[model samples]
Target: MRLHVADHPLVAHKLSVLRDAKTPSPTFRQLVDELVTLLAYEATRDVRTHEVEVVTPVATTTGVKLADPNPIVVPILRAGLGMLEGMTRLVPTAEVGFLGLQRDEETLEAITYANRLPDDLTGRQCFLLDPMLATGNTLVASIDYLLQRGARDVTAVCLIAAPEGLKVVEEFVGDRADVQIVVAAVDERLNEKAYIVPGLGDAGDRLYGIV
Candidate 1:
């Protein structure tokens, strides 16, 4: 698994405001959307495409178009839902899927509460969206489900990640050359309750008010 942390100045500028405790909920949501758009740009770098000949006003030109098997965008529900619009803004034609996963408070393990994805994902490129990569159990489980269904490649986009989460994902996806993780920032560590420290508080709560 390869990890990408956006280094662009604009990304950093928005992220700083997003992390501020004083930022209101409405503004936070907007920032998250904008940040995801920037992150999605890097995440879809390997999206499959095919060359096509198009007739421009002046002459014929060769351009690239997304391949026949449209890319799949799966947002791990609740918090992940916040990222969907931004991702689709980049690849509007991509198919959308949903996977609802929540963490077991006691064990900090991920449990799938809902899944509605295509049965056969062969030749499909999947983009998994989840805001926080705290422990990585949810992301790992989500990726396993996609790979099991024959997804050709998988990329996960997150707003923030913890070192512990990154390690777990890297180890869990060992030897999987086609998997990649794109995150805005990798925080210091995970707190006892399994939240990234110095990280933006619960993403779901911040985006939709404490639930």
Candidate 2:
């Protein structure tokens, strides 16, 4: 498993505001979108492409276009839904899917309650969207779900991550398939309640009002 922490000033600027408790919900939501767009740009850096020749009025040139079996964007719902628009904004032609998983507060385990993805993902490049990587159980489960359906290449895009969470993913995926995590930042650690420390609290509650 590979980890990429975005290192741009814009990412840092927006994320600093996102960490503030006083930022209103409206501003928070806007920043999430903008920040994800930046992260998405980095996440899709190695997205599959194919070359083709194009003719201009004066000459012909070779260029690249998204390959067949276009990449699929799967946003882990409901908090993950907040990231969908930002990802699609950058890859408008990519197909969209959803996986709904919630963590058991007591056990810190992830349970899947919904799935709206293709039955077979044999050659597809999947991008999983989830804002926080705290305990990492939810992400591990999500990656397992994708692999079950034959997905070999999976990239998870998160707004922020905890070192503990990253280690959990790395250990679980050792020498397995191709897995990468792209995040705006990897904060200090996970708190007792499994929240990323010095982190923006509950992404779902902040994006939408408490639910």
Candidate 3:
């Protein structure tokens, strides 16, 4: 799988704030939304489009419009849910889907507790949104499910990732050219519990307040 790490000062600035433990939930949520928007722009660089002719007051002009097969945006709940609005703001035409995946605390294995995606995803370009990529089990499982349903291409967008997770996803995708990962930053490592070290810390908790 290919990887794209956003290389912009503004992105880095916002990420720094997000990383600070002192940032509150309200601020964290806002920053995440902004960060996701920036990453989505980078992640959708190859989103399918087709040439179109438009008639202006002066003359006819040619432009490109998003392709017929609207892209699908799936946000792994519930942390992933925080990124939905930011992603859709950029690709408003994209269809939205949901998947509830969480790691088993004891085993650190991803489990899909809920899924609400189309059965036939043939030719669809899907964007999977999740805030963190630490262990990668959830991402691998999510991609596998989308591929199983016939998704032709998949792009996963995350705010932060660990080296271990990146390696895991790369190995899991193997020679799948259609799969790619877009992240804001690759942190140093994963903690014992499989959390990204020096990460923003439990993105779900930071975004939505403790339950």
Candidate 4:
């Protein structure tokens, strides 16, 4: 497992606004889209590509195009849905999938209530869109599902993460296929209730509403 914290002033600045409790939902949603797009740039740095020849008005040149078995983007339901737009804005050709993983409030365990991904993801590169990485159970479970279905590589894009959660994912994913975590920031800690301390409140709530 590899961890990447985007290092950019714009990312930090937007994250600051996103964290403010006073920000409205409309603005919050827009920022989430922008932030995810910014983070997506870093997350897809190693995305697979193959050489291709293109004939331009000036000359023919060799370039790279997304490899076969086009990358799959899976948003982990609800909150993750908010990230889908931003991700696709960048990788418009990437295939889209959905996974409804609800974490029990009491147990804090991820449960797969729904999924719409291809059963055989052989050689497919998958990208997971989730806003927060607080406890990591959700990500670990999601990754396990993909790996089980033959996806040997995955990249998870989150707006922010907690060290404890990152550590959990790293240790849990040791030597299991290739995995990478890309985030805008790593907050201080997780509060007793398992909420990310100083995080942008509940991402799902902020994006949609208190439902």
TM-score of each: 0.97, 0.98, 0.98, 0.98
Candidate 2 residues lying further than 4 Å off, grouped into runs, are none
User: Model 1 — TM-score against the truth?
Assistant: 0.97
Question: What would the per-residue lDDT of candidate 3 be over residues 1-211, giving only the tens digit for each residue?
Answer: 8999999999999999999999999999999999999999999999999999999999999999999889999999999999999999999999999999999999988999999999999999999999999999999999999988998599999999999999999999987648989999999999888889999889999999889
The number of clashing residue pairs in each candidate reads: 0, 0, 0, 0
Candidate 1: residue 23 lDDT (0-100): 93
lDDT of 2 by residue, 1-211 (tens): 9999999999999999999999999999999999999999999999999999999898999989999899999999899988999999999999999999999999999999999999999999999999999999999999999999999999999999999999999999998899999999999998888999999999999999896
Weakest 10 consecutive residues of candidate 3 by summed lDDT: 172-181
What's the TM for model 4? 0.98
lDDT of 1 by residue, 172-202 (tens): 8888638899998888999888888999888
Which segments of model 3 are wrong by more than 4 Å? Answer: none
For candidate 1, give the lDDT of residue 192: 85
Leading candidate by lDDT: 2
Against the reference, the lDDT scores of all candidates come to 0.92, 0.96, 0.94, 0.94
Ranking by lDDT: 2, 4, 3, 1
Judged by whole-model lDDT over C-alpha atoms, candidate 2 comes out at 0.96
lDDT tens digits by residue: candidate 4, 68-117: 87999999999999999999999999999999998888999999999999
